[model samples]
Target: MTYWQMRLALLRHPISAALAAVNQSGLFVVAIMGTALPAVFFLILLNFGILLDATQPSPSRLPILLHLILLQLLLIGLMRDAILGSKARLLLISVPGHQADHKVSMLLATLVNPLLWPPLFILLSTSPTNWPLMGAQWLLPVLLLGIQWSGLFAPAPSLVYLSLIFLLSLLPLSQPMATWLLSEQGMITLLLMLLLCQKLPIRTLFNRLQRLLSHLPLPVSSYIAQSVIRQELHGLVLRLTLALMIVAAGHLVQTQVAQFSGEVQTLTVSLLAVIAASWQLPLNRFLSAKREFLLSLPQSKICRATLLGQPLLLGLLLFQFWLHHGEHCWLQIGLLIMQISLIQIVTIRAERQFVLASLISTCAAMVLFVTLAN
Candidate 1:
């Protein structure tokens, strides 16, 4: 098969495609949230020092803003590589795809997607004079992505690149540099880096991984476990890390001053992550697919019982986080209960209408959340 055909086939892989479709709905939820001033303000408060806080003398939005930008960049980067990718697909590409010439498609996959550019545009629209930093912004991540893509054969790339972003998170930049990194320039630089990383004999390594994934029972178990962890576990880690990093950055800026107490904001952010992650259950996919044997009425009742049990289980766990962090834990706990149930029920009911179900469920939950806020 030709290379383009191979790449398309890989993108069509079930796990990657299904998750991408779900995330698309999640992104829709985000855009809707952006329209609410209170939601946006509250989110900024979670990460950023309020620009007008009268009590703190040494306050600036720069650190928090920069951290926010970097966190989003890291998230979208991983989504491009991981949620939208499968090792099996990459393996197929590496075999029949192209050894050295796959750079163009790789670049396209990274930079030329639907939801990325508008955010990049908004970020860049801030300042036209800070163009060089823009280039650096894209370059830094792409370079890291390249290093990451190259090392994906072994375990080194992900750790190394994550470490690199973590270290970069600790660095302080001037306003202009920060502005540049916040724009399309940053996105391009990161994409090009991934393209460069494809210079390796990825096909050969992919063939090896594919073989390993298929042959031994141990390998099979590992892949299955990896799939579950990637789908369920680290999904929370991704958002939680963003919250923690922002809190950490805010703390660093405030250490020189004694007046700042950002604990409430930090706590709010942590809870925010917990709530967001709870909504990522695979209920829609579960109900939509008939790949498994059909449940009898009794069996369906048991399964529904288990599904209803999810919100309770999630609430208890989230309560532990909320109990330590902030007030209104009960309110959020109640909100989570409603949100999960609505999401799960809507997803199941709208089984084949995955997108419509998520959109309706999310909007309904958001309305309830806003009502509670008022």
Candidate 2:
């Protein structure tokens, strides 16, 4: 097959192909909306930069910020094979190129996506004061790609190193170096990232998860059950990291919101819901297939079951506030719990358009609670 044919084969998975057939119009709408995100992001960032400059007239870090996000996306594409199902992995391996060449092709394909262009435009739209910084911005990808190339032999280490870079850069010690992500001083973080790219034991982590999961034999009564459990097991690291981030976000947002307003809370709750929804999606389908009676539950009963433990969530948030601020942050705690609970409830129960349900429910709940709080 030619290169483009090979890329096409890789992109068109069985599950997605079936879904496209089932809902072509919906899929087209989704594609259009997904493509529009870059435009939306570009306008938002461009205007924000303009507003900030109008207020204080400083050189913008906007380009560095965009490059950092692009770096993460590139790393995620590299990690895709590691996270995807065995079936997908097998199919990918069957594609007719050397692994390095295949990865290069995937990288090229990912960078060509229209969504990434907006950040460049956003940078360009900034004042000429940002031009010097923009020159440095182009080097960010080169540094990350260089680090990625150096770790072609150990994808796991490469990923772990990247994650560490992100985490450490958020720490106080790295703050001085964080200002310019592509300058010589900025290369400190990248150098530290490359140094940390020694072989990580990610395979061992997977092995341990498999051992524990196989001990109970994976609920293999059906394909859905088996696939759900396998994928869940494979996701232990990601799930754990997200959980930790959620916990930290819960505490950190009280401080962050003084600057960013409810956007931080909105994003935090949205993320918590997305993670919950992702887990619940396949599990709900598997259970509905297996028990069938779960489908027979009264709507009230289902709502009660899903919305259970609110008091606990509240208590935890209260404790999070005390842990971070040593006082009753009633407003913060209430807003977070309401937002998270509303989003999770919709995601768990709503059978169709999970994203829409979660967003509408969360937004409505947020508006209602904020109005009442005020």
TM-score for each of the candidates: 0.40, 0.55
Summarize candidate 1's per-residue lDDT along 1-374 as a digit string, tens digits. Answer: 77656556655564365456435645334333336757544554433333212133322433443344344444444444443345555565466546643464455445533223433444455477765544533343344344433433323333433445555555555656655444466546545534443454556776898898677665232333344445554454444444444454334444544343333333333334334434445533433452253253335655545544643565455344334333455555665565555555554555345445545554555565556655
- Candidate 1 lDDT trough over 10 residues, lowest sum: 50-59
Model 1 per-residue lDDT at 367: 60
RMSD in Å for all candidates: 10.8, 8.6
lDDT of 1: 0.45
